[model samples]
Target: MNAAPPLTPAQISFFHEEGYLIVPDVFAPADLEPLRQELHREIDRKARALKAEGRLENLHEELDFDRRLAAIYRDSKENGETIMRHLEGLRGGGFHAPEMFDVIASPKLLAKVGSLLGTGEIVASSVYRIRPKLPNIGRGVVPWHQDSGYFSTHCDKQLIITCWAPLVDATVENGCMQILPRTHRGEVAMHHTGGNAGFLVIKDENLPDDPRKAVTAACPRGGVVFMTNRTPHCSTPNYSDHIRWSMDLRYQSAEAPNNVGLWPESLDAAGKADDAFYEKGNVACYPPEADFLVQSRLHPEQVTNYAEYVRRRETYDRTQANFSAFRRWPESVATK
Candidate 1:
């Protein structure tokens, strides 16, 4: 196999200093077309179902991919409902469309990840998100919060990398991500659940005194913005007429403790065998779905396919009896 692309010294330095990095032209049109096609297929199915149920009169088939969902919700009686309601359900904190597997497991993406991680053994995190920032929708406006705020405290020391890729050109008017420089150097800030969609957000009192330091990451199609788990970032509202389509995929070093790639094997290490762990108010990393191997130097043959991905997710849903309802930090931690 070909060697993964390596990050230049300058690029690596910038990432460490700013807590985020933007790599342009890492992907081509071909790399994104497959994922777009898959999205269209799923949207078409949803439209058909809605029409059959009399929730929609026309399928709005003439509308482009960016306008279809907005038009559907506008034309339907479900005017109060958001476009996200019609999209795929969140699996392991994100959308799990089978068609997205190709992009999720793309070698090119893994190459970039390997460069930053300095290891070929990379594990894809289960916490990936497909964000469709609809026009004039408040739900698309994410509030300031570090990615670490959503994860278990057990993984605090591990490095989790988030790659936010936009299918279309992302601009300030279309809800592109913005980040606070060097915020990763600090501890996770006090966050509360109170955004456009009840998303976790750092309280305003905890925001940096210098608000002008935040930088907007206006990326083009096929470009990606990589941020550390502790990076403080959020997106503005989508004021444009079209949907701002984007996906946030995460990766971590395979050797990291609580590595989701190890799945059933990591379960023991994550304290699945210890009932006392749960009783003591500790939660496992992503207790909802089964994570799978994406790229492994030691066991390349074991990389998960679409079929296995589905099987494992299904098995997790069926066999895992209860998911932890605890999603917030205690007052002591949040106040600190």
Candidate 2:
């Protein structure tokens, strides 16, 4: 095991002041060998082919995040014989492989995230995304948006810190993420649906006239760009010859509110709780893999009344998707 590097005072001060920071050389490039091979094998076979064919489709439309959002399967044979197999173990009942958990639990990665977040007990596991950026593909751009833009707005605050980790080297040439520095101080910018990837983009009334004059954070693989949920950012296309594969992970304190509604359905199946409970709080819960801690920061009385929060969130999530409130981009802008 490598010795965990001390978080520099400068880095701490910068994150405190700027709402985001890029930590470079945090993980040894060579250390990612196993994941790199597995990721490339998966992307090269399935994701790469999809991009090549200009097909941006996701099978799991029923999922809140699945609309217009594309994903790669580690074990899908749909694109012909794939080399990878989904591990029997899963987190949150999602399709994550056990090896994916190994990467998240890596001592080096955990130590860095824990240090920044000020929590030792963290659930960095939930969603695993492989955004495939294929060579000469015009569809690679992720439109300018904030993460909380698409999520449930029922919580009192954003309780998430997202970590974007690239399996291959990410660069400006490959359309890595671009950020508007220090803008997280503003209100969570109002977002409706954007044409691309169901992204959360701010309306012209909510955006600065000259947002392009903002700074962009483009770093190498193994380094990470950490941001609050409200931070504004976007990525460009993969015009370069190489493919860009990356994963976006959300880490939350056990005490924060979540999307999963109250309790587990399996527990519901056992008749411990009723359907009403499921509709309210269980939806807020991360998939089973996150292993979220139920001890919340809310008053004990409020925590006990999770049904209220769950119901409110469900309504809020729907209201957010109402298209009439949004300024729709041209169909071309949405697709490309």
Question: Tell me, what's the RMSD of every candidate?
Answer: 4.3, 10.0
Best by lDDT: 1
How do the residues 1-336 of candidate 1 rate in per-residue lDDT, one tens digit apiece? 776466788888898888899998778968898788778777777678766777767778898777887787667636314336534336332345666878888888888888888888877776677778888878778888888888766766678899999988999999999898887877777777655576787765787535468899999989999999888898999999998999898888876643243334334533254564455543435656566678888998977788877666655543443644335754322321
Model 2 residue 82 CA deviation in Å? 12
List, residue by residue over 89-144, the lDDT tens digit for candidate 2: 12113223434545655667666666666766554434445555554445456776
Residue runs of model 1 more than 4 Å from their true location after superposition: 1-4, 77-88, 91-98, 259-284, 317-321, 325-327, 330-336
TM for candidate 2 is 0.66
Q: Model 1 compared with the native: what TM-score?
A: 0.86
TM for every model, in the order presented, reads: 0.86, 0.66
